[model samples]
Target: MGERIKLPNDPHSPEFWVAVRQAQGIVGPVATDTISALIDAYEAAWPGLPRKLADSTKEKYRQSLRVVREAWGNLQAESLRPSHVQALIETLGATKPGTANNVLDALRAMCRWACGPREFLSRDPTQGVTHFEQGEGHKPWTPEQLAFASDNLTGMLRRAYVLGRYTGQRISDLVRLGWTDIDDGGFNLRQKKTGARPWCPIFSELEVEMSTWEKRPGPFLLQETGKPFTTNGLWKKLDKVREDHPQLAGAVWHGLRANAVIRLRQDGYTSMQISDAVGMSIPMVERYSRYADRKAGGQAILLSMKERKQDKTVKR
Candidate 1:
């Protein structure tokens, strides 16, 4: 050969070699030994996955696998060790324990796939690795934070916030909300994540806010262009709004779900009632109602003390 083809500067880029192979008219699957190739093969056989992965879940996997591919794409799949997986998790856990756990989950799923009928890898690297401990999940918005958001956000963003707070729905479900869903004094929806059919009654505050809005033919929340928002589209818009308003930074959309549960609990709704209203399980309802429970307990104790003191004075 007069001259050898030069490899790309980034030696670990699986895409570069793939392009080269295509250019040379080589039409076949990549060598299965490398991690990158094995990952590709595993994804190609996605339907064979143990459980059906949702679109949102697949998006998370894609994000985690990008890091994995960058770090060990060119290495042999069999070379991945538990130590390597553990080290990666630890490094990622320093800043984002939740993300680290998600990454570990992705790795475990991929490795398990490879070790099964696929046989892309001889062993699982993530076998002994574990996820980082996570905290109490999303932080519910304080009343002050909620007031600030309500006063500041306008138009579609305001509508989005009102829907999230009052309806207690996820951003995914929120994007799909429309006038059609409104019936019998509530919004009836089959939750996308859990498939629970919840009928969230129109709260007085929500009704007052909605009464002023111009009725639309599409979804309740729309872009400035009058188009209904995709889930990612709404998230990006809300993120931009949050960035501009630092006071609203602590208030996340998912946290609104917790806020809704707490509000119902504070209003004296039972756990079963709250669960029915929010389309959440009883355990989740109890978890979110903890703050409300403490407040209610304190109020009850104080009321009992006042009654006892009044009786003592009467007897005196």
Candidate 2:
């Protein structure tokens, strides 16, 4: 009633906002205004992130930030309640658990960066949020499904799918795969996500797929103009391939990597060996293998039960 509070000029800087909070008595319209400015700055910074990160990873971070802002932009940063974060996560879970977790992680980082290097909040809102539980039933595909999809695929898509399955390279890496990357008995390339170099032995099946494509100097996977396929274009091609085989419409591009992991286990590769071959961390290999092993075990149990039943019928 006596006087209106004024917000700091550089609200985006944590130091500026902290000083404003300390001197201006942190409860009122000014604090709220400062929080709003911080959010605006965060949103504005999203586009520039790609300059510092890979295009694929930058897109992921941008998507995560967009979800968070859409859910909670109106609220003051300090006033963000646990219920608010929970609601955001629940909404994200409707689409994907992994995506929801990624959003939460990005939000956590933003909060930490905005507040200070040290923990500024009294309690972390996302501390106890539960993520979706995954199990072996999430295996990529059945042999029948794989065969059907492969048989229906053609052109670049056919090669792309087969390469992904056999090499276990991500879509980003697969599209850029070139003859130069392939050598005497294997392929060597650095993963865009992890920047780790992995050398995968060329299997006979993959060799057949490679033989189908002509050896060229430009991008291994390209459009008619001979340019490398963008992420969206690559997915669109895969989507078209799925359309031809309706049974595979639900299959994701990354599922090829999962299929490779399952095949590796079936071929007696240890988790560590599979992780090394796929250029993934030990933890990721272990997590993915859990599902593959569970599926394999279930199949073995079913086969054994059927055999036992046949034996009992013969004895009778």
lDDT of each: 0.82, 0.72
lDDT by residue (tens digit), candidate 2, 1-316: 6466665565445656556555656665444333344555555455554334456765676688777766666665567777878888888788787888788776775565554442344455666766665444335766777898677777777777788889888888887788998767887888887677777778899888777788879657888777888768989987776677678867877778888877888898998888778887777677767776787899999999999999999999
Measured on C-alpha atoms, candidate 2 has an lDDT of: 0.72
Any runs in candidate 2 off by more than 4 Å, and if so which? 1-52, 70-84, 87-99, 112-125, 134-139, 149-152, 194-196, 281-287, 299-316
Model 1, 28-62: lDDT tens digits are: 86554687776665565566555667667777888
| Candidate 2, poorest ten consecutive residues by summed lDDT | 28-37
Error of 2 at 299 (Å): 5.0
Clashing pairs in 2: none
The TM-score between candidate 1 and the true structure equals 0.67
Q: Whose TM-score is greatest here? A: 2
